[model samples]
Target: MEAYLAWVAIDLVIPNPMNPRRDHSIESEQMQEILRSKGWAEAITCYRKGQYYIILSGHRRWHAAKKMNEKEVPVYIVQAPENNAEELDRLGSIQGGQVDWTPYEWAKYTYDIWKNSGKASYSQLANKLGISQSLVGSRIRVYKFYPRIEIEDKLSNGMYSLSMLDYILKWIKRVEKHHFELYQSMGEELIRKQMLKKYENRCFNSKIAIDNIFVTSACSKDILEFLTDINKKLQDCQFELELLKVDNEVDVTQNKLNVKMIIDEIRLIECRTKNEAGNLKEELNKLLKEIELKENQLFDMVEN
Candidate 1:
């Protein structure tokens, strides 16, 4: 096959109107807008054996160029091979290097080509694409199960990484028996609530453990009772202190009266015999005698 650039009017016919590659919606619209704005309506494709095949590397650009009604789009021609197998192999190689086609896209496209051409194996396709057989298998699996609209949106938005797509496909398949919206909403809500509850419980447990270590430990049932008792005692002590502060002179007077009242009460409650009371009286008399002696000595010095 020869590969060379050629103009649009090179005796080529647009073949296979039902070509799978021609189904462009998201990328095509963007391409058309861009070309209309920039006036760069030229695009590239592959031509072979009197048939023009559009290999959508830049599918949007091709669509835009077509929309502009441009008579001729630039292309690279590959001469037809001897057999269908060689032709498909050539097409797969060309598609393998094409841009805008993701791994999933390439996987689907390659699978279709091989299935149609009846010549390519999964291993061969994986080798040609420089991907693992398992990965190729996974891509094929996802292509079979994934929602087309979701996959297309993700692919266009650059959010469709292989791992994420794999996860989404697995999640969808697991919940396939359920209603789509119900399953989606339930999954999302469950994830959100689960994460939220996990963090909240962690924070609460950490706080409780810390408080037990550094502050005080109490059961939830006993905490209110303990706090109430402590608060009451504190309030009573505060009230007494406030009264004392408000009248310092009255506080002193009241303390003296309290001392006298305590002495009178002790005397009234005496249960000692007359002999014991006499012994106490004699001790008081001795103390008074000592005080008198000291006073007399002090007076004599002053007089002299």
Candidate 2:
């Protein structure tokens, strides 16, 4: 079949069942807003199939059009893919840059392709998909482990994250190793559920905070060192900013002095003249105490 563009009735185009995307509510609503304001600009990509056309991409746009009671919409009709794998590849390639696939969504399509292609090698599949083999393996693992609809929905909805999944896997390994007694007592399924619940409740709104808390819970010394490095860099930036305010020429001559030597001199002067050093010391002390408390509490939670 020859590929061509045409205007089709809104109802004639159907969403692909094999498309990895499960949730379109958010994207569709955003597109609906765009349509109302600027009107439709991009054509839906689809392929001829029987009396109706199956969408290859632009499922969200089609949804948005229907929601707004659009009568007809522009569509680019392409030749039907020879196989499911080809169709999935086309969809992934087309949508790759526009929007990221959710962790589970990516897993779903990757698993489907692997399965449908007679269980192809991870290396071959990864090469074809332009991703690492380890990534392909991990996605397949995620798909298998979280096959339950409810769990997949939570991951798709962004209630949890891909990093959280990695954390959960690490926690499981630790439970199986150092915490063997707890693992035996709780069993695998319950341990998984409990960990999910624990992280879900503790998950923060910000990625940085989530990483901080997770890292702190796992190893406080690392997070403390990370914070210390960040603080030192912040102080350096502040010093540079102050110098820029006083005279731009200070920047030109900054390389002449050892930056560390300059910072130490400034710190010594500030320590002599200001109470800010005392406050920072107190804050660091408080943070240390809080971290110790959290470590103890986390250990207790894991054991109980």
Number of the top TM-score candidate = 2
lDDT per prediction?
0.52, 0.70
Q: lDDT of candidate 2? A: 0.70
lDDT for model 1, please.
0.52
Worst 10 residues of 1 by lDDT: 209-218
Tell me the deviation in Å of residue 266 in model 1.
71
Model 2 clashing residue pairs (backbone) = none
Write the residue-wise lDDT of candidate 2 on 92-176 in tens digits: 8877667567778888888998998888999999998899997888788667765456467687677877555655655465546
lDDT of 1 by residue, 109-160 (tens): 6556556556456788678667887777667666665556546555656645
Residue 2 lDDT in candidate 2: 80
- TM-scores across all candidates? 0.41, 0.58
